[model samples]
Target: MNILQAKNEIKNTVQAYLSKNSFGEYEIESKNQRPLLLIGPPGIGKTQIMEQISKECQIGLVSYTITHHTRQSAVGLPFIQEKEFQGKTYSITEYTMSEIIASVYSKMEETGLKEGILFIDEINCVSETLAPTMLQFLQNKTFGNQKVPAGWIIVAAGNPSEYNKSVRDFDVVTMDRIRYIHVETDYYVWKEYAISKHIHPMILSYLELKPNNFYTVSTSVDGMEFVTARGWEDLSYLLYSYEKMLLEISQDTIYEYLHHEDIAEDVFAYYLVYKKYQDDYGIDDILNGNVSSSIYARLFNADFDERVSVVNLVMDGLLRQVNIYSFEKHCTDLWFGFLKNYRNHMDVSYVDHVKEFIALYHDKLQAELLSDAQKHEYEFVLEQIQKVNVDASLDSKSRFDCSTKPFFKQKENMESIESDLKLQIENAFEFMESAFKNGQEMTIFVTNLIMSAEMALYLSSHTIGIYEKYKQVLLIGSQKARLLDELAH
Candidate 1:
């Protein structure tokens, strides 16, 4: 089972104890407390579970790392000779009183709990020198000459001895007194919690990376170590910029962080399988070539259904290994190229489907062009005005009054004409695919221009002959050319 499932089991087990109707036959005023043991992997949140239970039960949690305490810390130093008490002849036992009570009072205020919880993290990591003292405390719930506060409950967590070579074996005497709950990693449950919090999308995306497949390098002189869940979290933030790294990071950055080169090697190894396929045949050939004799000859030799299944499995696995964001960008660029080609030679039905997307893009392009044309016309008029103003030879006042107003008006009219002609030309281009509906190759643009009256006058009579092959879609001739000329002016 995963860490979350293990945690829930522990919580449920403790809740049963808490829910016990009778507290050792003592009246409601008195009770007996049962302590607990949490056993789990290093990063699997054993201590976190105890804290959660304390909060849910409305009890304060005080934690100490047993591994950090030594014989010196547990046993007080003797006082200086002269400073030692004379009348009472007290020993360090009197001073140990102050230290023990200090640990108790804080629990009283936080939980308002008649009894609170004492959380011992990494209990199994305690040094051999301090192990006897820990056993004494566990056996009697007392340290030094004094007992732990009456209302306090003891809960200890430790990584399994199997996890590390340094982990010392726990004596059966210490093990028998408390319950043991084993915890494992559970990314699925963590994902649910992360989603509920509405975690940042970018962070959530990294978290969603396949848990078993990712890692970073270690800085050991001998070699690299594997990354843990905690290491992944730290490296994710560092990799957010998505820039490729050059040299190595400093020791200070990764000294305490875990890294696993094996996982990284595995990921690279997975990638090479795809590369091997490419070396044998081109990517396009693999994608579009005959399957039976090509790269997938073995799978192609199978039944059609089995071959399809194998193809799907390989594709899905390869796709999952890819950096999705980059793959999506590549697909979008390819689709856009297809769109441009489709605009040139597709049939009417396909063109109509393509038009929906183009309609929005077309409006944007037209608006941009119209804005540029107006700016250019305005600049030209300004240049003309400047020329008239600077020329000492010209009549400046007449030049100012010389009907540039008509030119400006013509430009405005041309702007409107340009918009109209652009719409017609775009429409003609858009409609050319109509001839393809019946699978014909006639050039509709030639016919439309030939029939256009405005276009006919601009064209020599010889030019009309060029339209003989496309008489099916004739336009009204000069009408088209006049419209174009107006827009051009």
Candidate 2:
């Protein structure tokens, strides 16, 4: 299975495991519920999805890499205790709470969530002495003498034996005690996540052009070399940052993230080409519906790679505007919701009330562990709310009126941005029509927009003439292809 499918499956399993009976006890007893074990290659988003699962389930999360722990730490430190047996006192060993177990309780207290996922990474790579303890922990849901809380689910992950020298294969008995999922590298699945994350379109385009390079791991004379989804995502952040800072991205910078030398150099070469294309073409001019004849001629004469690069360039620009619109809409809607809720309170000290609201939201967000986009929205909302600077001495109405200005201006600016975005969409279509016409480039442009969550939303809400027309063209083309395939069959 792919990581996304694994995520959905794991999420469903977690929900089902947490479901309660009429007596409020879990339907699946804690001891009866086998732990979830994920086996996959390293850096393929195995560890990344745990937090997402916890957040989606509205539960607490405690994560640890078991390879870092010694047997003592994993099972807790043993201490001497006195007990009476057969009317005689004897010494017995009792262990303190394991750090892993303690963390679950701490998270439960901090987040006010009784149920959650305790995710242990590199479970198969634990030290030799800790292997038995791990098996026992998996079989019994215990670290030391403390069983995991009733509502909590235990999920463990590890790199496959081929990926790590220290990996230990579980016996049949241990295997049957848990449910295991094997995940492989999947570009399309990761692409869906990467697109939502707004990974550099250059990376997306390169991967689309050379899907084989999306994930490559091998041993060579120089040593292990690989390119992972994590590397691409981190590189995307660096590229965007460097672009903003006007810093040159050297081949060494690409090499730093993408470990596979061949793939890294190939991507760096594409980066150079992309930059050159950006310099050669005026994206702002295209978005404004002012296409020079020379530019149109260059595009018309360009090859498939050049055309794809240009399409990606335009998409990068479109994504920028659409993301801003999304952020604004999210922030404004949330802020406006607060305002609507606070409207019933007509007393003084609304500023303090608003401040409390912001602080509570901030604290809750820390516990919820939202995705990158949502985190940005929440941060922006809090910042805007803080900057409102309403005079607390004034009456409630006056204070509310003063506090509302920030979102008011934000909403107005959002409207103006939407207008500009609509014009840009129409103009983008016009450029595609004049230059690429009904070529695959048009299909690429329309298909990508339809795939994007924000772009799809924007397109659905606003009826741009050329955009709507191209969408119909795409629909008809898809139907025709399907019909032709049917006839051929």
Candidate 3:
């Protein structure tokens, strides 16, 4: 399964494992719950998903790399204690709580979440001496004598032996004791993720032209040469930051993230074309429905690869609009919910659900579970909420009137965003129809929009005429030009 599918499966597994009985005890006892073991290649997001799962499930998380621990550290240090055996007193050895287990408890206390996931990375790459301890923990959910906290799910991720020679294959006994998920790389699946994440448009466009380069793991004389989804996302961040700073990205920088030479050089070459499009075609102008005839003439003269890159460029802009709409809608929802509740009640009790959203965002931000995009969204919303500081000294009605003023802007912003996005969508389709004689560009744009949950959500309440036509054209290839012409007329 792909990482997204794996994420869903693991989330479901965690929820099922944590299901409670009528008396509030776990439906399945702690001992009976099989710890989840995720086996896959490195850099496939096994580690990242745990943090997302923890945040989404509103649970505590304590993560560690097993390779970073020795047996003593993993199982805790031993100490001498006095014990009475029958009539005689004897010295006994006892171990303190394992640091890993202690961290789980710490998170539970810190977050006030009794249930969570304890994620162990590189579990099979532990030192030989710690291998038995690893297996023991997997089987018994214990690090030495201290068992994992009840209601906390144990999830471990490890690269397969093919990816890491250090991997210790679990025996049948150990394997039978856990729920194992084997993950693989799928470019289309990752593409959806990449689009949602707003990965560097150039990287996305380049990969779209060359899907084979998306995930590569091969052996060469120089050693193992590989590229993975992790590499692409990291590269995306650096590209975004470097471009923002107006710093020139070198071939070496690309190779640093993507170790494969052939793939790196190919991407670098395509990146030059992306820059060419940036310089030649005013993409923002195009999205605003202002396209010069000379620009279309230049595009017609360009090759298919460059045309595809341009399509991705246009799609990237449209998606950005969708992203903005999505964020504004969420912020508006928070304010709307709060005001609704406050208006219904005589007092601003519980401050409505806005406080919950704020608290949740703060908790995730504190835990560093939110991605950069999420962090910014949370911060912006937090800033907006802070501006409407409700004064307790004022009467309830006055307080509501003063504080509710800022949220009114959110409502207006949402309306403006909808209008802008609808116009942008129409402009993108118009430009796609005019620039390319063949409908592949429109095909690419419409296909991506269809895949976007954000676009689907926006379109539920909004309508785009060309989008409806293109969706039908997608089903009938022969009708693509007819549909484009129909929309054009």
Candidates' C-alpha lDDT: 0.45, 0.84, 0.82
- Candidate 1 residue lDDT tens string, 198-268: 22222333333344432333356766465555554554445333324543333334334444444444433
Quick one: best TM-score, which candidate? 2
TM-score: which is higher, 1 or 2? 2
Instruction: Estimate, for each residue in 81-182, the C-alpha lDDT of model 2 and write its tens digit.
Output: 999999999999999999889888898888778888999999999888999989988888998898898888999999988888999999899999999999
TM-score of 3: 0.90
Instruction: Give model 2's TM-score versus the native structure.
Output: 0.91
Which scores greater on lDDT, model 1 or model 2?
2
- lDDT at 475, model 3: 55
The best candidate in terms of lDDT = 2
TM-scores across all candidates? 0.43, 0.91, 0.90
Model 3, residue 146: distance off in Å is 0.8
lDDT, residue 17, candidate 1: 42
The residue pairs that clash in candidate 3, if any, are: none
Q: State the lDDT at 218 in candidate 2.
A: 89
lDDT of 3: 0.82
Range of the 10 consecutive residues with the lowest summed lDDT in candidate 3: 480-489
- Runs of candidate 3 with Cα error greater than 4 angstroms are 348-382, 385-399, 475-489
